[model samples]
Target: MNESKPLVEGAHFPLALSRPDLIPAARYSDPDFFALERDHLWTRTWQMACRLEEIPRVGDWVEYECLGRSVLVARVGEEELRGYHNACRHRGTQLGVGRGHSPNGFTCPFHGWCWNLDGSNRAVFAPEVFDPALLEPEALRLAEVRVETWGGCAWINFDDRAPPLRASLEPFATYHDALGVDRMHAESWFETIVPANWKLVAEAFMEGYHAEQTHPQLLARSAKSGYSAGTDPLGFVDPEDIVGSSLYFMRTLSEGMGGGMVHARDIEVAEELVRMDLPDDPVEALSEWTTRLNDEIRSRASAEGADMPDLNALLSSGHIHSVNFCFPHFWYLPVYGNAASYRIRPISPEETRFEVWTTTLWPAGDQASTPREPTRRPHDDPNWGEVLRQDFANLPRLQRGVRSPGFDAMRLARGVEGTIANFHQALDGFLAEREHADLLPALHGVSGPIDAPIRDLGL
Candidate 1:
């Protein structure tokens, strides 16, 4: 790994230091920094290209585009998938545009060059039209991109020398596996373009510190005692009526976020918990209520053959996170048996393409029919649930504010904002082109959910 360089004055996008708490302002708005990420981070990191369900059958394919490159991921055999650069070897024409089923194989629209499902050259349009050297079998084969599957998605890495996806994703993979994340599938998908740097947009969802102010509807207020400074912002339930307060909390959270954090069935389980006889002490009652609620939710889902994981076990093991961040550009909030996931991509220094998916477990074969394409909308559209609309309102303004001359670096909360800090630190390693062995430990530190003070990542 490169030694920590002293922060030089007037440097363009200087690399971050060993401390994972502060971030330079220029990293978010500078074109040169974005170019560095395009060349190093995006190309080397393992990124989710598409869900495995999207290409379940042989010959099924989807085109994934990033920066200016397009890759086609296709199922070639009953249990095998392959990825290839989307361009044809002949004339450099794109062979696929979007999701498709090519039972016969891909044929170039510009010319008559064709490639089989396994990325082997099938046939040339005419033998006499090209030089013999150009038609050599090895030269005509499609170029392959590295691909692997995990958590039900196909992840691709442009760098052939990059470590295997599982090895790079350490403790994060272990946690998600404990939660049965591989059994989950998208229930709804949506996309929008936000006028904000990709990191700015992603950082907005990395912490819960903004929830009390930005999403007032999600706040709990006492029914009898009314609002008071002593009231906990995290929970507003009145001690006198534990049942009513618990019900209100669950319903508001489920509705305000549009059913991703808490599913409809989870609400039903909470209602049943409220009716049972319990202790008179409000604190004890709340504790018992929470434990039973979690247990019942899992048992019911399992009884219905939903392949649900042991929520109580995961919680006791500390594997469950309200928000888990996979370094580079992915985050997911898992609650009950449902989860809400976010992915962001840079379009420019001030613009990003963001996507959200509401995911949950279903019967074995039921997820095959879920929609593969996200419904595109403008960032300001109100139809994005109450919680998200409130969150989106601040993105563009934050992007503009970061560029002010008087503003300097971001001051992140040591405890709540550790994910954001860890992200930038790991990014700096990539921009510096550090050795893979040195980078893996830092990547593991940045991989899991964040809710505590900054950790010594061994940078």
Candidate 2:
């Protein structure tokens, strides 16, 4: 956080890349692609590690799981952050567990191989047992990993000459910076052991085409009020209309949901009731009629003899999730205009963990105060939690479907398929370059070293 120092870069570099959209059907279940990604892709990239609040003091540290490797990030000094292999510098034993402060630097319980927060080798137990010259600081500091911070988050990379974070994030930096999100303390996070590859889960959120059938609660109650998602240039929009279009309907929920949501007019009354409760006039403030709209979708589905999924309970329970997939795994779902942050990390090809936190920025005065025990969600509230039991419950089953011998491929929507295509392309690019080393020199448009930005921090 010291402004005067040279901005830091991660410790690694890119080894390869793939064309974003043209992944083979076999990659999903192929053990070969899985192994390559674990080694070349995940290991080399600078990844979002942990939120700033997770470690707020000197010697603070947290363990992160990436691919199959376990790593640790530590706050060793007032402004300097360090990363280690999470293994003892001595006999390669695992270091600290969970998250907490380590004021005395890191001392391995096994054989007392100690590390300074700055990652220098401070001491070794039983000095007489080892040669004095070899154990000195120059020779024995714990191996350092690369680290950086943006938007109050710290990221780390394991490569020694890794590309700069800013460069890799260049295309999306403006949007990333515009997110006025600080770290949020998650109230609850739901984890489902999906049977599908990590890519499948990412694809599910990348596009909204599946909402009509997969998310009746979201589509029926909130789709009309501009049910939309911001897309990267990679977004796939189906050109064909009515028969099958891929555009996500720009949407938001009317700031309320309840039994009254069964009808559209009642939702309007509820919004009025909410507006009256607030001190400011709701007419001028940014607002929408999401909660005020409803289609007789359930009855229509029934009349058309559609075998409704068991999601009637969730739709009737009046819960709506305004989730934004912040490209890759950052699912930004805020609630009631409060603060929340969600990130999913891949543990392996088929398993990923979700980290959800609810936090609101207190803009330093009475105006920034957030309501405690929030009970409702606005479509635009980025701080809301994605209980997501309804969303993630079927993933494992879907994963299993991909594994079925009879199923080789599934269709994607045209208008809404952009993210899905982009994700596949990104994944393919990552996997392709990793496997084919010769392609590196030919990567014309995107390959460049980005230096850490040197900016005035107003010292």
Candidate 3:
């Protein structure tokens, strides 16, 4: 989701057409490019849906939409979280509005054709006229799609035969046990109606390249230390020990949980540095620290007119945020070491909606360490609210710049560009494989930023 442009501000324009394979600004301004992404990339990809805990009981349901289709997720029991088309069988109206609880079945508001939790038609509006097909369970039944869950998340595909979620997430399962996704609960969530594509949203998280430039609040501390983030030969999010004294909080977590000798490993190190004061059990240390930091920001944000407490509580649980960038489009950012969360949304052309699903380690029937208190909802958070406001202010501007005939391409620095490139590598892979993605031709000639390996001290 993170990106760089072909030009800069109030300065001499340096046309860095380094990556010749990619069309300079196709992702930003091209409607055809967006169409291809919608048709091939999103529809074919397995997406992060609700966490298994969201609908713990039979008949619980959640809604999902991608590729212009609204998907309804329902749980018939503890084990099943299934997807439907979200349309009522009778009137063709959306079965559910925003999001609410449906105890045992979803009765359409249109004509009252009720569907069981298993997606079967339990009661048809008019059962007699087409009685032959009406009585034939399948005819009146809601259309079912594919569902799968992993790393404490639920995923669904409209194509029943799409590869299982596990197959798509290769070599990632080994680290799943550390995520503790199932033990988490929601802390807080807020949405930004961004005027850019979903890729713009992702670009923010893709790398630390823009940290100093885009995130001044975080840079106040991050700029002070030993951080040199870049890409490895394989294009991973590489965070090495920082060069100087200033460092960010995430370094602690990264160093603590690091096992992979890949790019994102640096983030693990950064997080570990952040949690330096945490307990011996890095997980416990991570959880405690997250709750404290998240709460502080929430309190300050609310005081400023931008705090959303209920959402903050969901985020501060310490269980979510441990896992960052869990997949291509979603970020399982466990701000605390103890928990993890799911941040995902499809880029519908120039518009995108971000869904932040939070969770704690505690499952149904399990006791949570944090006392169960009345959850309060709020309108905004000032401290963190300003943070996002800043992003929203800038991203759309970046999206706008891609359209100018003056700009050509971007030039990424070695250390600061890793996260951005890692994301692009993933996107490139998807585009190359997609039949609709003829966009690969635009990015073919971009040269490598770093050679095979750039290690300090040559371990």
lDDT of each: 0.78, 0.49, 0.50
lDDT (tens digit, per residue) of candidate 2 on 265-328 = 2233333333222213222221222222222233333354533222234335532334444334
Best by TM-score: 1
Best by lDDT: 1
Residue 262 lDDT in candidate 1:
82
RMSD of 3: 12.3
Tens digits of per-residue lDDT for model 3, 1-459: 024532212111222222422335656556766665666466666777666656666766777766567888777776767788888877689997545567677888876778777777888766676657446777778887788887766787655545666665543443444444444555444454456777667666545545556554443222323233321112211222121112343432223222111113234343444534545442454445445555544444345443233434554343222324534566654433233333546555666665443343322233322322212222132333343445556767777787678865544444445445444444544444433222222122111221111111100
Instruction: Write model 1 residue lDDT over 203-241, tens digit each, in one string.
Output: 887787887789766655566555523224334343346
The runs of at least 3 residues in candidate 3 whose Cα sits more than 4 Å from the true structure, single-residue gaps closed, are 1-23, 131-135, 216-323, 339-342, 346-348, 357-389, 413-459
Count: clashes, candidate 1: 0
- Return the TM-score for each candidate structure: 0.92, 0.64, 0.63
Question: Which candidate, 2 or 3, has the higher lDDT?
Answer: 3
